[model samples]
Target: MVTAKPSLELVAEVLNGHPRSISRLISRVEARDPECRPALAQIYEHTGRAHLIGITGVPGSGKSTLVRELALAARKTDRTIGIIAIDPSSPFSGGAILGDRIRMNELTGDPGIFIRSMATRGALGGLARASMDAVDLLDAAGFDMILLETVGVGQDEVDIVQAAHTTVVVSAPGLGDDVQAMKAGLLEISDIHVVSKCDRADANKTIIDLKAMLSLGLRMNSTTGWQPPVVRTSAEAKEGIDELLAAIDRHREHLQHSGELAQRRRRTAEMRMLKTAEDILRARFISRDDDIVVDLVERVITRALDPYTAALNLLATLDEGKSDDGGKKRP
Candidate 1:
């Protein structure tokens, strides 16, 4: 139960990289109360500035290695990177797995990179609802690139795209059926496709299959500007990492040039507001003598009253009880 107000000094300290305060700010916003609402508002104002890249694929596709390489590439431009690793996937721990990629440890001491691991905690859409809040916190904290990694097979990976501006759906040679098999949910959302572990023999066939599938799926009125491109990369040998990074940068430029960046921000804002409203309504409705609503519904079941009339009566009672000043009845 957070009772105290959100401190301005706390926000500033977190933004300034006060190590102890940074995690605290993230916790506060993710807990999601009225107290943290103001902080979230400020955080969203800075959100459109972060290039959100969602990296996802079926199991063992080397998403972790890919994300670390991408983060390292972003550093070349002096951009701060935030990596969010989700549950049961490629997590070494809640702490960053600096050993996953070479440059991951290369800048462990650098303030430019922030990494956090997330658990499902019983929410859907790849990451938890709190993940968006946490990302907002990171974006406001001045990270230029935020990479969101997910847990699960390909279909589950698609949900991450709804949260990101650029979605790179990774697949590998062993993941042969990823295109035709998982086409319904995740593949439809990809803005970029990645064939990782390209060192393997069947890699070319996987890429060709993906291209054919995309050719079948592309529609005349699609919203995304550029058709997603498949890039090859082998994290183990560090081959094609540069080409993959180049594809990501090209996608970012395309988004900016084609007004898709603004569209993404608008959609993100809309989702935040809708989710927040649903949360508040559920909280208030449950607290409003919920027993009364339950009891009344039981009576309706016995035919003493119709459900519609019973609901109206409940609404009147709720309205009257909530008002400090008397509100007129609905008759």
Candidate 2:
């Protein structure tokens, strides 16, 4: 029987590109296990070298298939790829419903590719809370490229922009009203647009409509000076995958040349900081002693205290608890 390695040793093994160690670290992160923190802290210094790309779109956009094709195309260039495929959660178990192991089975035997399936777990913005943490682990493990595929929840996918250096939005033909849904929010956040399943005759309509919309709006982030290009891809025919990769490469080059990469990195850091803080506060709020909030809840329930005042009062109790503990926070 083999004993488990310590966290630091596991981090060392992961950095040395041990696949099993990398998977174990990601598992700990997804479980939100406290033991994972030290390894994550060590991993952070080795990150920022990997190119993180986010792929998002509505349901039936063939995102999984497109991702598989993109990975295959990218591997031809000899680049190691790490894929985080976010699937909808199982209502009963809160686990990923469609695992990457099944969806991307063809790529399983490749040594250069690593795919992880994470459940959205009811998280808004189409990503799991632990998704970025998994990305960090992969980045630290020396992967050249990381592809983050969201849960295909349209409009709520804006979070991908905050998490990735480049965001690709996939659009499919004959999605009925889903195309209109893109006009509402997803269109504004895409760095590159892809019309998947272009083998279908109706695909031209989607390509034309997307291009026209791009023309209407500058479709360019003023900072990056990039006009999002629509690339047509047919997984069945294996066409346009190379062009899509080229578009992504061009966007990365533009970001580097225009110095927008540094700015985007800074914004990503700030957003992550704020989001982490919100999570911490929410956890503390939920874990607070029941006795402390019961009175406040009763007061608000009876209209003796306004909800706003009761909320303030609850915060005051937290402050008091902190003071009593010599400024250290309680679990």
Candidate 3:
């Protein structure tokens, strides 16, 4: 006799804060397993309650350190937390190269905090395709706050803006030209700008440059009259972290009062739905005969058909096939 798959009840138990089941559920979601859908459906209702916070910036800006400090500060309020650290993937194993858990050793053994490190797997914006799903799972698992730390890639880090309710862009002194942060499009998406490593000698200069940039209206202003505040923090020294946390709380409050929280959640849902539909379409396209795709590619290579026209033809073929299947199922 074959063993049956775990029921949604078991998954629900996990969502009710079962520690052992959390990682297993996340793995299933990451693998895109069909069996995970029922659990996700039930868990979906419990999401949107957690405060989703995104932390991103250039490499060596001390993002991981700040994330740790932020988590610690949040714990002081007796809030449970979840952390998703997106690390660069190893070329050979496609596993997270940097051990984020090791860096967050201080938070270990805390039942209230769940930490997960995901490999980017070459995805743009330094996020895995399953990052959002992981977030939802954590939210359903009853974490009061969720922090998403992106791989420290420059411009592409903007993708986190759509995934989190609050986006924090971190910068530090001695990381080269401070002006580069303004040009990299970080200001536009940031809900809070953190000048990290304030203990450094040039930290004051970095903070001044950030304030100057904000004063110039380079950062996008929220319709709620909320201006993204630039906060200073020395994660290593644990100085100014409370101020940074307060800034995040103020931004959250602003979003709630201005009705922007609902708007942001709606946008996040729209993006996730679109990404799912795109993945389904791509899979359907590739599931057709291999020879057909090979032939199409060969024709394009030999100038027999342009790529745009070929794509249209392929889409048409897929549509016709779907119509044929529907007809067969009728009566």
lDDT leader: 2
Find the number of clashing residue pairs for candidate 3. Answer: 0
Q: Can you write out model 3's per-residue Cα lDDT over 1-331, one digit (the tens) per residue?
A: 1124463755667677876677777777777777878888878887778999999888878888888999999999999999999888877877666676767999989999999888877677767788998898889889999999998867655789988999999989998884564555777778889999888899999988888877777444634588888888987687988998898889889889989999998899898899778776776666665466778889999999999999887777765776767623111
Give lDDT per model, in order.
0.73, 0.85, 0.82
Candidate 2 on 35-68: residue-level lDDT in tens?
Answer: 7788799999999999999999998798888889
> Judged by lDDT against the true structure, how good is candidate 2?
0.85
Residue 139, candidate 2: Cα error in Å is 0.5
Query: What are the models' TM-scores?
Result: 0.80, 0.93, 0.92
RMSD in angstroms, candidate 1?
A: 5.7
Q: Which residues of candidate 1, in runs, are more than 4 Å off?
A: 1-6, 88-107, 153-157, 219-225, 286-289, 292-321, 324-331
How do the residues 149-242 of candidate 1 rate in per-residue lDDT, one tens digit apiece? Answer: 8765546545576689888888888765667777888787788888888888888899888888888867842666587887888877788877
Which stretches of candidate 3 lie above 4 Å from their native place?
A: 1-7, 90-95, 181-184, 218-222, 325-331
Q: Clashing residue pairs, candidate 2?
A: none
Give Cα distance to truth, residue 296, candidate 2, Å. Answer: 3.3
